[model samples]
Target: MNFLQFFVWGAWLISLGGYMGRNLHFEGGQIGAIFATMGIASLIMPGLIGIIADKWINAERLLGICHLLGASFLFYASTLTGYDEMYWAMLLNLMVYMPTLSLANTVSYNALENNRFDIVKDFPPIRVWGTIGFICAMWAVDLTGFKHSSAQLYVSSISALFLGIYSFTLPKCPPAKSENKTLLSSFGLDALVLFKRRKMAIFFFFSMLLGAALQITNSYGDLFLSSFKEIPQYADSFGVKHSVILLSISQMSETLFILAIPFFLRRFGIKQVMLISMIAWVFRFGLFGVGNPGEGLPLLILSMIVYGMAFDFFNISGSLFVEMETTPQIRASAQGLFFMMTNGLGAIMGGYASGAVVDFFSKYAIVSGQSQLISRDWHSIWLIFAAYALTIAIFFTFAFNYKNGLKTVKEK
Candidate 1:
């Protein structure tokens, strides 16, 4: 269930930029706008569907419905040529697809609990397969030469359809009962009360901030590698020829890092683990800023390895934190809220901000008359991202407070 959930995403998420820029002739900002659809849907759909799963619908059923609908949209999107048409198609696609992320977790957790399994211990290994699925999709796309073509969308669409059908076969997860009957409560907006707590508020704030970094690499990392094809000396480089495969290293690293989360959380606590994640982001981007396909290939490989720590530490640990902190009645809603802050608002900020930065660097090169055909300064763009991550880490070190061990919260 988890594997196919991310396989659909992996097929197109990272490679779409290359296709958009190389084949569709999209500008940096337009590409960012396209990616922002996920953010927009993240902001709206997850919470709404989470509310449904919490009070009215079965999570597994909702997950199936969302994916089925998303598959249709993705299929239609594959046929689009115009930016406006593709944008709206993807927007609709994401609206249905984003919520399934939370729903999948809800279903999985409920199933695990029913089987008397420990989530913290068992879930990571199970979830690690999702990353493996992602890697498989990326490799499939690259090997088939679909990375720079619209074929990637078809790959995603088929996977979505498959997962949509498979979702209905999972164990049933009925809505949790809630006593209160109100409009806001029905929509699960009652979880908004989490903002009233100082600790929860601060954690969500940083979640949003750190979330901004989540998609930056996905948005441009492949494009960055493929851009080397324009340079004479590096035109034939393996990194340029198989950019999607190269970037899949990060996903491979994620599989490993996901397994390390339990130890990190127990030993260092959430704060330190997250702090380490933030610092790792600095290296993730810093290495990209200086690395190339030749002698600097090692730096790029290192960056990909570090990406595991940077991503898993915050995302997995944060999800576990939400699970351990919130009441069972609001558990799904709280998880949706975490997704909203990170992938929703944070993603929007990162998309536009990073796009603007890319455009600015490109404009600078044109203004300086370096060459009309010269591409944007990727080195500067990556360094700026590294600096942003560093600043967030420094502030997060002092701003969020928690102890050095996992504090148990009794499940209701």
Candidate 2:
């Protein structure tokens, strides 16, 4: 279930921007707008579905329904030629798809608990397979020459359909029955109370800022690699031709770094671990700015490797921090809030902001007395992003108040 969950995403998530740019001729802002749909959906749907699952529906059944509907939307999206049409189609798809992420986790946790398996000890290994599945999907798409084509969407669609059917076969996770059934409580809005605490409010604010960094690569990394094709010397380069496969190295690194998290957290604590992640993001973007496919291949590889640290450190660690801080009654909702802040608000802001940045750096030419946007200065763009990440790291170091110690966050 975990494998298929991310496999569907991996098929097209990294490559979609390239397809939209090359095939559909979408501008940077338009592409960003399209990706922003995930943020918009993340904002609205996850909380709503969490409420539904908490009070009314079985999670597994809801998961199945979401995927089935998402598969239909993916199919429709593949057929779209216009940016506006594809935007709406992808929006619909994400609206259904995003909730499945949380639902899958719920299903996994419930099943693990029911079988008396230790979730903290056992769940990480199972979750690692999802990253592996994602890597496999990216490889499949790149090797099959589907990365710049609509065929990637078909791959995702078929996988979503299969997962939708398979979800029903998972263990039943019934809604939790509670005696105090106020409207807010019924909808899981009780988690909003966490903002009343100053520390939590501050934590969530930073989560949104860091979350902005997360999807920049997802939205533009492949397109940036493929852009090298515009240079004659790099036209046939391995990285240019197989951008998705090369990018999958990031996900490969993620699996490794995930194993390192407990040690990092135990030794350095959340503050240092997250600070390390912020520093890694600076390297992630800086390396990309300086590296190319030919002599700089090693730097590109290093960038991919660092991406593991950049992603898992803040994202996974932050989730764990939320888990440790919140009470059990609002635990699920708190998790939802963390996701909302990062993937929802953060992604939305990042999408539009990055798009504007790309557009700003794009060069224009007067061709036959008609102004035309000719090329993007990718190096400058990456450097700017690197600078942005560096600024975030600096601010985070001074702003967030937490001390380093193994005793603080380690599970007893």
Candidate 3:
């Protein structure tokens, strides 16, 4: 379950920008707009779906249905050659696909609790396999020459199809029993009350801020690496020829970092751990700004290694924090809210903002009568992003005030 779930995403997520910019000739803003569909769908879908999972049906079953529907969208998206059609298709796909993330977590959590295992301690090891799966898919796309082709969507579609069908066989996760049974509670609108608490409200606001950093690399990392090929001296470099694999080093780093989450969370607590992630993001982009495909390759490698901590500490640990902070009856909905802030609002901010920044630093050039993507000041762009991350980290340090070790929700 964990493996295939991320394998589907890994097949396309990291390489989509390269395909759009290189083959489709999309402008930076258009590419960012398309990626923002994840944010749009996230805003509109996850919480509502969480309501359904919490009240109407089994989470595992809904997860299956969503994946099946998402499979169809993925296949259709591959057939699209225009920006508008592709955008809408991906939006619909994200509408269904985004919800599955939370649903998968709900199922995994339920299964673990039923088995008497500690989620914080046990979940990371299981989730580590998901990162391994993601790395494998990235390698598959890169090695098979699909990194800039529509076929990557096909690969994702088939995997989603399989995971969709296979999901039904997982253990049943029925709706939690509810005594209130009111319309508002049934709709999971109750999750919004977390905002009324000063600490949680601050935490979620920061989640939105950090969330903005999450997809920047996924949107442009490979595109940035491949851009080096335009230079005559670096044309034959391995980083340019197999940029996706080089970028997969981030996911490979994720696998190792995820396993270390339990220790970090236990020792540093959520606030300090998240602070560490914020600082790592600064390094992640700063190193990207200074490195290249040639003699500077080790710096690029260091950036990739830093990605593991930047991503996992905030993402995996953040979800576990949500689990610790919400009541069992509302846990699924709370999880939805957590991601809606991060992946939803956060994604929208990152996508469009990153796009506008790229556009600011780049322009088009005509080469051989084709308007090719060129003249991008990638070094400047990455540095600007690093500065943005550093700014956010500084503010987060002052804004969010949690003391660290996981605690049960203190319902005020």
Winner on lDDT (1 vs 2): 2
Error of 3 at 47 (Å): 2.6
Order of all candidates by TM-score, from best down to worst? 2, 1, 3
lDDT of 1 by residue, 56-112 (tens): 888999999999998999999999978899999999999998888878888999999
TM-score of each: 0.88, 0.93, 0.88
Please give the lDDT score for candidate 3: 0.88
The model with the greatest lDDT is 2
The number of residue pairs in model 3 that clash at the backbone is 1
- Model 1 CA deviation exceeding 4 Å by range: 54-58, 110-123, 169-188, 323-332, 363-374, 407-412
lDDT for each residue of candidate 2 in 354-412, tens digit (9 for 90 to 100) = 88998898866676754445888999999999999999989888878877455754535
**Ten residues in a row with the worst lDDT in model 1?**
364-373
lDDT of 3 by residue, 73-141 (tens): 999999987889999999999999988887898899999999999998899788777878888899999
Counted clashes in each candidate structure? 0, 0, 1
